[model samples]
Target chain A: MLILLWLKNKLAFIPYFRFMQVLLSHSKLKELISSLAKQLVEKHGSLNEVALVGIQQGGVAIADELVVAIRKQDPEAKFEYGQLDITFYRDDIRKNILTPDRMNLPFAVEDKTVILIDDVLFTGRTIKAALDVLLDYGRPGKVELCVLVDRKEHRQFPIQADFVGQAFETDRKDKIKLVNDEKGNKQVVLITG
Target chain B: MQLSTRHLLGIKDLTQEDISLILSTAEQFKEVLQRPVKKVPSLRDVTIVNLFYENSTRTRFSFELAEKRLSADTINFAASTSSAAKGETLLDTVRNILSMKVDMVVMRHSASGAPHFLSQHVPAAIINAGDGINEHPTQALLDAFSIKESTGGLEGKKIAIIGDIMHSRVAQSNVYLLNKMGAKVTVCGPPTLIPKYAAEAWGVEVNYNLKETLEWCDVANVLRIQLERQNQPLFSSLREYRISYGINRQLLDSLQKEIVIMHPGPINRGVELDSDVADSKQAIILQQVENGVAVRMAVLYLLSGRN
Candidate 1:
């Protein structure tokens, strides 16, 4: 009976794992992250006073990767990195409540250039919520949005990403996610049912 | 995820999962309280009215502070000062408040099931502050939060609810919450002060001996002797009750193991608990008060998420 139950669980999970199409492979993702780091350096010249605040859970990995890439280039990049949970500020809370992620902004954002990072920029709602959370913390000198994948259409709010790894058109029903493979390699996949 | 029930009428209405969620959410809110800017914009567009029929100090302030920290607009209505003094009904008063575009109501009444009745009649979300001696849900949540903070978790921990178990909403709420969370509970007080069938009805141990109850439990939640709530004499005298059940320094020092002490406030210090015990390092009474705001913030935040 236990074996049958385990087999049923595996059968239920197989289709979800098998049908996903990889939009960005592990190597491509690495290159994209490195190039994004270079782009950030090119734009900011130096990250001494700039701070990278990742929208929690999804954006944390990308932010970590970008920090490592920048450190490899400059060895002394002193940009402050933090994670922000936008659960409290979401506009769709009345519809459904999601569990809050960890928030760890140790440094003050006052008068510093804050770059808000996320994995995918979809309906612009998460970024909007992140902005509200940021302003409540302190008044930053300037704020910029950074994302790896930007769905170029169907934005319910007027918001845009300042830095992007890739921009594409996706169906409103399609799900785009950045996930880790079993070997601990990062990859982007589009799951459709 | 949101809470299972819309109205926090009592701990009896909450599932084990719901209690855990509220505690975890409160953990996050506790971190928020330590921040430089301690206010969050979660309930910015929401307006809550605190309708307190019974006089309160801590619970009222804690709920109002929680609402403020969530950035919700608030209006406080005390029964002594409000139109309720003119014999306005609970439904009529609440309907009048709801007519002013209020989204939620935090209420406390001397009558049990008052919040439950208000919830059925109104479209607004209702949170029971304390409805007579029935249950105080938020107080239990805060108590559980405090216990978790001190003792790690609630599961399998022996907690003794000491003194005035019959008259205490705090004790009853703690019993329901602790039982649901897999904690062992014991009701300890004089025979008259303890409810009949507390052991059978709630599935908790009943012990009249304070020393034995203190030795068996990890945490001792001593309740206040509510002089105002008692219409007739339940105990012989205050001095006798003190000699029998009051937690003193010498009794605690004589215990084989160190036990955490707790109290729901406005303590009749000499009757149920001594000053030294209440102020000792082993006591988390003040931490319980501080956690009240955070737990309440989590409750309001989660409930406001529901449609």
Candidate 2:
């Protein structure tokens, strides 16, 4: 009765719910992650233990969402979370201010599918950094990249996102911002200079 | 020119032409942060190092986030755990990192002249994060930027940096920079912190009590009182510190609502300022934090030659 009652109320709350979403709708990102997970499993066979590594700060949330999405898509898929602190790996560490904490997953990554997630896809250095760190974590069946926004711009590295939400263009100066709300509404916008 | 391989050394190193270029660059950068697409193309191949010896969350993080938004490679090195802790000398570490060939270095050291030292030592451009209560030039610039952006400009403006003037690199830097930009500067702290002939060097007025100074100033930039700073007794207690010189709701009433308030924070909420006052409408502390990134971005881009 409580589930039915909640479902009825949720149906009523749909329009306003979608309108006020900030970053990305949990449902939508979940849907995207699910779609990607389905393709991965269908090609590579059933996932045993899958590890989602976020690129710290922004990427962590996306990885968490993807984990939930993967579990929902394939109930048999075991999930693990990890983060990379690439501060030390950075070339400019000596000249910057304070470093953010290294949020790392202590679990072993042997024989796991490590799908790295980040909020936005830029020049891929951050992804490159994450990849280098994840390589040290352990050998995995495969490493995949997923991002919420993949702005079609010039990238310094030879990497591409396996799963991309939307690709857009920006001037050399303007920025691409994706804001995710508490309710999971995400607005991706292109700013002008 | 590539934005990646430049170094930002000091504010004084920036010519008026360089200053204008950085501000315009920052203006463009700020536009990107507001856009739906929050990533910029500048500094694509560049790497930025956040080397902070001083414990600061605001300025340090602002630079970090700025580097992130600009699509530049960023590295953070706090003093708590690093070669600095390994008893490795600062120049030795800088030389080692320089050998690694990182693009730019943003440095904050507890020792005064550390930034200047880094400037001399490193082949990479060095932006002074904060040096030993000596000169937080960027923080000073951000405060000026916030005030200028809000209240027209700094020309003929009356700005007071109150509390713990002796130990405030912020006050010292702000005094020189704001005066350079044609703002009337006033240093007001308890008599001990506001020592003899201190204002004379900067050619600014000095004030003792909070009341007259609060009324006279257009901007009251409060300094965080390092309680550990008093080698001898300056104030009796935190309560006495608050009662004597703290900027609070009562102090806010003495000035017009438009008069901006500032603090280089990790603010001792009740000691140097009241809680609500720090977050109040007059308080541009957070704005100062935000402007810090944009200003430092400008500073870094200038010294970096990647411009």
Candidate 3:
């Protein structure tokens, strides 16, 4: 696993799995989450002006893990947490009917540094929709992106994640998903034909 | 999830899953209404036409506002102003509108099955706002949404729909929707105002006594006595109806348990529901109107996704 982590971006040409391969196991996922939390606290000093918003469905799980990690580091952390569902703001709404998930942003987003967290960054369309949704709420002081795993070089929109747990150069058709394992643990997996 | 039917012609046409989908989507739209900017761009590319052959205040405004909230381009057509008043047929009016690329039609007519008639002739989606005494699907959806919001879920809940049951498209639609959602419904009014077939056909309890119905139910959806629709007097007078069926404060206080109150707009003040009960904390009459936009938006959004 350590060797696989060291050979991060070099796995672009590796024969992709037919079934699935666990990219980030339990312990490795914990390490990446802690690192992401540390980076957030280091960048945004007191965590007072920052608001962590998770994209609904997958991103919410990663956001929960990050919140726990951040709280563990600083027990007095007073950052705001929110969950957003961007199904209504999507550009492909005319294609098919999509069911919306929960969206609860009790706190104000005006003039706050909003950090959007997602499980995997792929075509960047979800981020675009998230940005549209956030702007409707209020003007933010600053907007940044964070993802547990970044699938590089496949962005359809001009969006990038500021804090990334892992970056992989993979095929356009390849799928990277953050899912829960049997023991109720967060794991990132790569799926291919 | 998508609606099973292409047109929201009536609640009888919807499956349990379809009702659940619309209510859940309405819940999301309700949240959108609470935000500072209460609009979404889901239906920005769609064009809708509201065709009203009959006069309406709440339904028309609610649908127009719902369309605006979804960012859909809307053109309002009243039978009094347009070619409809010049003796133009419903089919021709709709066809002429569709020729200009209208994607959907929200219609209300004095004739029952008028929207259904247009659905067979037109290419666009049809949403029946109200059709004579047939059904008002959006009103029922909003009532269901309000009931769910107030009392939680609809399953196994007792709901009494009181007042002019025979002439109410709202009452018919409510019966269909609430029944599908597992709510035990009792239609209460004077026997003259309730259809004889309501019990056997709709599978709802018919009670002429308002007090007994109120005591048995968890929610009282008091409907207005539609004087405009009534050709002849169903009862002796408004004062007599108020004495027997009116839901005053004393009648509500007599019940052992508190019941959620709901009305589908334009209350008669002292006819079906009294002023004190209408203004009380138990009444969700205002919420019903507020939920109307959200529920209609959900319907339009779901139907526009269909081919």
Candidate 4:
């Protein structure tokens, strides 16, 4: 299995397979997440007034990892955590059927510093929708975004993430996938036909 | 599921996915209804005209509240006060309203397919609030939404729509929407009230026995009898119909399993359903009304996208 993965990675370096390159290994992702948590703690001084909201599906796992890393740095930190599902807030709702994820925001978001977390930043439309949905909850004192991978192409909205793990440029046909193993191991891969 | 059609004329024009999309969108609007602000800026720039030609209290109020909650400017046009009462045709009245640069029209007319006719001629989006005995799309959408909220989903659920099936646009719309959502619909009423072609046309089970039908269902959606619409008595008497099919607390207590009860009001308390049963814990009648605003909000939001 190790030899097969190594061969796949080596083949991904070829120009033809460049679209299917694995950007970050599981350990590298963990290191970046830890660094992000440390940066957040230092920037905010404390997480008492901070609220970490995960955009559904892709952002959920990354949000959970960041929570654990933040806790490790400050065990007594009391950061509010919630999940936001922006399915209904999307502009393309009339064009297609979107199965909504569970929206479970248990606490109030009023007057809190909200940190929106997602897996990848692509066209920035999802972030726009998330911002619309979050306002319905309450007005936040400030809003910041954290993303795992930033695709520097085809952005239709004028929005950017405050903290990004890695940045890459890809063509329109290239697809970015964040894969997670059964043991919670994470990897980012770019796929193209 | 995207709503490909420009106007929501009936449930028959919608796909299963379209129904699902509407329900999910309504769920989000439901959340907004629970917020302290209870308003959104999604439709701030849009203008809606509630051109209700028929008399309505609940549906009109619900749609008006939904439009206001979405921050859309709305104009209420009743036929009693407008040119519709001056012998103006629906086309002319709607065209005049459209000329005012209306973004959408929520219409309730006395003639069937009135909205459909206006939809073809007018450029604005048309939402059928209720058109005679044809369809009330929003009512059915809210009924389906309430059922989904209670049971988590609509797939494989058994729903029995009782009373005034022939004169009810609600029954027709519910039958189509529920069946599309994979629910088994058994429409029950008196022999004279249940039209023969309903079963043959809609392919739904038609049963005259209410007790047996209720026993085999998960939800009982009781519709109000349109006494004003009936030119002649369809049944022998109101008392006779009530004795035969009226759902009371005694009948409900005898059921082996508890089932959710529903009624589209203004309910004839002693006629279709007893006040006790209507006020019972299993009844989701109030939820249906509350969901109406959210469902209408979703429909307006989606339709405004086309403009």
Candidate 5:
């Protein structure tokens, strides 16, 4: 009977495991991020005029990668970096209890072309909240959005990212997992029905 | 990690995570206070009522300043001139204030659990400033915030809360919060002033020896002896209490390593702490007072969230 139960569980997991596919591998992620950094520099004219503000948690890792890529291309390039925690500024704060991470902005955002970075762009609500919080710090010369995975159909707000690594269509119940391990292995996986 | 309750009635009602959240949020608000344009539009549309049944100068002003900094519309209600003096009940008075569409109530009452009682009856969010000898949570939060700033963190730090432990709401609040944040808390005072059950109840060490406690602690939070609250002499006399528990310059110099001195003021000059010690570089009483505004702002902002 125990063998039968184990076989039943294995049968159920097969289809779920089949649907899980890696969208980005470690090398591809590095190459794509480096290209994105080069593109940002090209658009902004120089890295000095550009400032990268990463949303807390996942976005910070993506921002770190972008900074490394930018420096790889131009070793003398200097870019303003910041990390913002938008937990307090969320519209659904009453429904959810969120403990915000530390918001560290060492440099001024004023009169700079601030490129807001995030890992996933789902409903665009997090970006909206980030925009609200960013204004409290200072007014920027221009604001742009960058995301690793843009769920194009899931946007609730009239928001769009200027630069995107990849875009995918998924069901409402589907989950996108950005797995960046401690060993510097990066992979994007889609778990869906 | 989020504060589950709408009302911050006491530190006893909060978890370790909840206290940490308040302190972290306060850290952000402290940065806002340093800016040229200090006001934030976080609570712009929210209205708060500062209802003080008991007389308070520091707590009341701090809450008011915090509310103003958040750009919230504030109304100050004192019991002396209010309808409470004209034989109005507490429930009726708050109901009247709520009828004007007040979103929150920051209250300080003489009776313990007074805010807790009103929290059940009213729909508005309640913040306990002080309710008798029960708790002064924001004061505890600000104290902890100041200590965290000075020491980098509260974990593994020794804090000795000195003076009238039995009657001090600040002492009770501090003991609960400091312990939760991984700080070793020792309640030091005269035996009469330090209740026997304090050690058993709160799991804090009770010490009568002031010099030993001072040497043991990294920070000594000296509480003012409440002469107004006490009905009879708990200690031998004021002079005896000062000699036994007082944090003076001589006592300050005796310590091998410099420790931070803290007082939740209106401090008695020579009672629990000496004047020189209160004004010294080691003292963070003023920093505690300044952090009070930021901590209250954080509390008000967190609680003001609604659907």
Candidate 6:
């Protein structure tokens, strides 16, 4: 395995099979995620057509870990993972970087249970933008939100996470960041105090 | 008490206190801009990137001046001139900048909500310079500031914004801000350009002709005709466009002469406006240009965690 070690800034996984491989080695999040996966499927009951859609960049790896853990119990379950870039749908359209990278909606998401996962949840607007886009394509039987960390702030939209690995109460001034560890495990950290 | 980086994406989310803060801060910066010094050390170590996907001279240069005055190192990045043509995406570019830990990003893109897109993915604070016909918050803010400066703060005044209502982001933004400042705004343009029920949506009166609009308005803001937007030729001809919709010198004669004339320009002389009217002292075209820098500086300073 050619270890592509970029301290940060690898987007879309365009050139390879594994993008966030650099993040898996640090924390024991993989083991913990394994235990949570068993509890989640057992509690929710069934994963036949359920799909995992990650909030791009940091959230994709965690979604992968969750999917792997789910497949362990029910191998026959259909699993589809996708990435969402909600820049265009945002209300604050002026502050975005003038030129975006390549804008791509590379998957067809129609009528599957979308388990939207993000590494850290803050204002919930990103989730809302993603949800708005998801609805534009097709209506799922049930659309659920899952996040590795829930930094509870006043949400502008009426949305909540279905599965939260951890929760933190923070003011508007604080920011929560999540990254993969050196041991191939994901870890969440607080950036601003 | 929060003094860290705060995003200034849209004015819709700002409180009256916030708007006052930005304008007052901008007012101070306006003095700094005029001084022989023409610079300040407030944002000395900061890195400001100008990401303009759309083509604009006035708005882009105003933001450029704002960054320069604050002593911030600025980089000009346009997609047409960058590796984007060779296939580099927008987020990939931001991630690269993120690695550099650049302080803030000011962006103007042709695609609506592009700024909002960057705010979500990137960690840095973002300012929307202008987005595709959605909103130009700073322009509206500065226009409001200029109006307030002239009429003792736009209270109980009739402001008319005339021409190209369908395409003018300036009209959409100013209508809202002026109303917020207690000014009765009248939007005048052709039936095709102005929406059929715009007055209902914007909570401002809409008129089809400029003559009637000018008689009632205290301030008349003229809008430029977008030549590039001529897909099927929006109007019959340039001569016809100027005659019917433009605030020409001939048309200006019949209106209340006290009404201040304004335009967010690259003024097509004799097209959307008469050459004499553009040069007229009543025209705040140049004032808007000059105030644009101060207004943007105020916006940047307001969001930059700098007082």
- Cα lDDT of candidate 5 equals 0.88
Considering lDDT, where higher is better, how would the candidates rank from best to worst?
3, 1, 4, 5, 6, 2
Order of candidates by TM-score, top first?
Answer: 3, 1, 5, 4, 6, 2
* Candidate 3 C-alpha lDDT tens digits along B187-296: 99999999999999999999898889998999999888988989998999999999999999998999999999988878888888878999999998888889999999
Candidates 2 and 5, the one with greater lDDT: 5
Q: Quick one: best lDDT, which candidate?
A: 3
Best by DockQ: 3
Which candidate tops TM-score? 3
State the local distance difference test value for candidate 4.
0.88
Over A93-180, each residue of candidate 3 has an lDDT whose tens digit, in order, gives: 9888898899989899999999999999999999999999998899999999999999869988889999999998888877988888
Per residue, candidate 4 scores C-alpha lDDT tens digits across A1-193 of 9997777668766767554567888998898899889889988877889999999988988899999999999998889999998865677754553556778787889999999999999999999999998988889999999998899677899998888888888876678888975686888887854
lDDT of each: 0.90, 0.70, 0.91, 0.88, 0.88, 0.72
DockQ of each: 0.44, 0.02, 0.64, 0.22, 0.27, 0.01
Q: Write the number of the candidate with greater DockQ, choosing between 1 and 5.
A: 1
Higher TM-score: candidate 2 or 3? Answer: 3
Per-residue lDDT of A109 in model 1:
93
Flag the better candidate by TM-score, 1 or 6.
Answer: 1
**TM-scores, each model vs. reference:** 0.89, 0.59, 0.94, 0.84, 0.86, 0.59
| Tens-digit per-residue lDDT, A17-111, candidate 5 | 43556778878888879888888878875578778999998888889999888888888888899898887667776565455677887777789
Clashes, model 1: 0
- Candidate 6 chain A: 10-residue stretch with minimal lDDT: A96-105
Once superposed on the true structure, which residue ranges of model 6 sit more than 4 Å away at CA? A1-193, B1-5
Q: RMSDs, each prediction?
A: 5.9, 16.5, 4.0, 5.3, 4.8, 21.6
The list of candidate 5 runs beyond 4 A from truth reads A1-21, A151-158, A169-177, A181-184, A190-193, B35-45, B69-71, B234-244, B304-307
Share of real interface contacts recovered by each model? 0.52, 0.00, 0.69, 0.17, 0.31, 0.00
